[model samples]
Target: MLDSIKEVLITQEALQERVAELGKQISADYKGEEVVLVCVLKGAVMFFADLARSIEGDVTLDFISCSSYGNSTQSSGVVRIMKDLDKPVEGKHVIVVEDIVDTGNTLHYLLENLKSRNAKSVRLVALLNKPDRRTVEVHVDYQGFVVPDYFVVGYGLDYAEQYRNLPYIGILKEEVYQSK
Candidate 1:
């Protein structure tokens, strides 16, 4: 799998340091408030776990799975909710944790859906942001890094379910997917 990587964009140490900083910022922002951290499943699992631990306040976790890409690098532009929150988010402060925001289609749909559910407030925290690819407007309250247009995988990001276990985020070689 290492052979298929073109370059490591973010080191493991960098990810850790940034996550810690984000945690501190979040803690301060929501001080004296209990927030629900909603993890956008599959891709943001590792980040969600690490971030939850770094937070220093009352926090509950929930998992939501949405799919726009299935074994493809590009999104089909159709968002599907594979899994919904186990508990109602009504009257709660909800934070959506995502691995990356590219086209913004999925997050836009999700934010609207969550808001309609009567959540007191719904905010977004994206580990990586790629504004160049956005097709819709989505506000990210907290962002860890701004990445260029590259097929990145690792630290919970994946390409066809591979490379999620990599310790750092890396650019996947084009040939690796082209050959598929």
Candidate 2:
């Protein structure tokens, strides 16, 4: 609900423009190769759908779900794969799509997992990055926004499994989480 938001951080228009730009950049970078997009669900679902359409080349979609936060605002520092990719990424150029990267633990765990499976190349494309909260180093090939460290929701991000359908990204009211 809009009542739960304190402010809109990124407008829907801005998100669309940026995602288009990212698509062009990716299409250029991987010109002749068939790119396998590994969607890190379920937060990245909305972004992944938009991003996939913007891409200009042959793109195949796959999904992998790794969770560090269950119902909490912060991660437990333990990355567990709730779901795994159905197909092999062996010798394929893989790009992991994520909605946000906060502490980098989940991304790191995912990167290692994909690498071990013999992906020809593994890169990251995150819609949002909270660099202030990062405890480990992460290399994001494409990033939409470097947001201030806040509990954000919308455009695929969520708070307690809610707010993912909001058209724009927004900061959740502090009291909402504090009360919990």
Candidate 3:
């Protein structure tokens, strides 16, 4: 799997440091209030776990799975919810944790859905943001990194369910996907 990587975009140490900083900021922002982290499943699992551990305040977790890309690198422009939150978000402080935000389609849909549920507040925390690829307008309250428009995989991000276990985020080789 390492052979398929073109370059490491973010090192494991960098990810850890940034996650810690984000956690501190989040903890401060909420000021000890309990917050529910709504993790976007599959891709965000690793980030969600680290962030949850790093946070200092009372934190609860929930998982929601949405699919915009199946086995392809490009977004299909349609978002589908594979799983919904186990509990209601009404009158609760909800923070949506996502691995990456690319085209913004999925997050936009999710934010609207969550807002309609009457949550006290709904905010987004994305590990990586690719504004160059965004087609819809979505606000990210907390962001870890701004990545270039490259096909990135690793650190809980994947290409066809592979490379998620890699410790760092890496740009996948063009041939790896082209040949598929």
lDDT of 2 by residue, 1-180 (tens): 788899999999999999999999999999999999999999999999999999998899999998999989989999999999999999999999999999999999999999999999999999999999999999999999999999999998988899999989999999998898
What ranges in model 1 sit over 4 Å off?
A: none
lDDT (Cα atoms) of all candidates against the true structure:
0.96, 0.95, 0.95
Which regions in candidate 3 have their CA more than 4 angstroms from the true location? Answer: none
Give the lDDT of residue 13 in candidate 1.
100
Best by lDDT: 1
**Candidate 2 worst ten-residue window by lDDT:** 153-162
RMSD to the true structure for each prediction, in A, is: 0.5, 0.6, 0.6
- Tens digit of per-residue lDDT, candidate 3, span 1-180: 899999999999999999999999999999868899999989999899999999888899999999899999989989999999999989999999999999999999999999999999999999999999999999999999999999999989999999999999999999999998
For model 2 the TM-score comes to 0.99
TM-score of each: 0.99, 0.99, 0.98
lDDT score, candidate 2:
0.95
As for lDDT, the candidate ahead, 1 or 2, is 1
Candidate 2 RMSD to the real structure: 0.6
